[model samples]
Target: MEAGNATSAAVLQARELVKRFGGREALRGIDFEAAAGELVAVIGPNGAGKTTLLSILAGISRPDGGEVHVPQGEVGWVPQQAALYRRLTVEENLMLFARLEKHEDPRASTEQMLELTGLTERRGEIVARLSGGNQQRINIAIGLLARPSVLLLDEPSVGLDPRQRARLWEFVSALASEGGTTVIFSTHDIQEAERYGGRLLVLADGEALFDGSADGLREAVRREAPEAADQDFETAFVAFLHHRGH
Candidate 1:
């Protein structure tokens, strides 16, 4: 489905989602909706509950309050850390995840993901020998095997070079545009959100501070300070956060 038709249905929804880690509240009631074919970037400063929110969305952790509407076993989650079989070949690692996911045709899925990640050429090499970027690619491939309608990722580009990062974003964009997989990712890179995120969800101090497009976020910041028209996105975003006392 094209992005035009993506808005027909909401693939995920968080109604007052809340989470508490011991005494600290990780999420203070987050509400958001995700369309079936859009890349929604969740951006925030450190310790702003971005990870906690993704955990809830991925069903890895239960929220203390509120509700998230996502079907069981229909979500692909990639944590910041790479989870791969370092001793196995790239193809073998993908196959391992495919079987774990119980994909109807694990081999076919592995082939598709191998080609998708551009790992087909190096499929026979051990994962430990691959560069950090290639390992990250394999980590992403493992998540893609779930054939999820909604894919959630937490800082998947931590160690990639510029080219690798570009390739990864292109791959994700294709999934959202052609495959209609709703992609929700968390990032501290503000410019990334402005560049690739079709929609943006800004969290601060365990609360949702803004939810809209990059232009919308800029316009929102501009409303508070007309002098910010010339500033870059990072500057404007910090100003916006400062305004909210985050």
Candidate 2:
């Protein structure tokens, strides 16, 4: 995608975003934007409000302050788990979600989705019987059943092994490449973030500590604090946390 084209295709924008949980503030004046076909990762410490930010973006929860503007009919959401019905078959689960979204030809679309996720052979199998990776694939398929323009995932690779995680990344990358879907996800794995994310958003104490490409982040660390260059993302992340006093 050209720079101008990407900039023009901003699918989701959050400005001065804030979320409060009683006495605590989860997101504090956060600002974010995702362009068409861009893959961005939101990285933060345990309580840095990554989930809260994703929830508001997914419309699963509301924010206490700020504005979230997403183009109508452009957003799709996949939560942490493949929350399919254990008793339902893979095909059945996809069709059900499609129908719930008022999609036409849910059956056919479900079949196509199965093929896309490499679950065609297992379409008739019960979700409960599928492996953890396969089940998560179904979860992602259901989220994409609507053919959303903007895809939001909350720790989509949380419980999977290395191979499963890699497979999921491949699927997500293909989706963005082919469909121009703006993808945003949160992950605790810095390696995953480095490998998969086109851009990075580092949050600490509900504040954006870094907003740029992964390379840019590296450069920032090298420029601001040279000692962090040899460390991996986890260590660098901790350095950021400590430096920020979070």
**Using lDDT as the measure, which candidate wins?**
1
C-alpha RMSD by candidate, in order:
3.4, 3.0
Judge candidate 2 against the unseen true structure and give its global Cα lDDT, from 0 to 1: 0.83
Per-residue alpha-carbon lDDT of model 2 for 146-233, expressed as tens digits?
6898888889998899899889999999888887898999987777888899888888778877777887776666665557758876
Q: Which residue pairs show backbone clashes in model 1?
A: none
| TM-score versus the correct structure, for each prediction | 0.94, 0.94
Worst 10 residues of 2 by lDDT: 1-10
lDDT of 1 by residue, 1-246 (tens): 001212548888889988897899999978888988889999999999999999999998999999989967899999899888899999999888899888889899999999999989999999999988888888878888988999998998888899989988998899899999999999999998888899988998898888888878887888765666578768877877887788
Error of 2 at 196 (Å): 0.4
RMSD to native, candidate 1: 3.4
For candidate 1, the lDDT comes to 0.87
| Candidate 2 local lDDT, residue 149 | 89
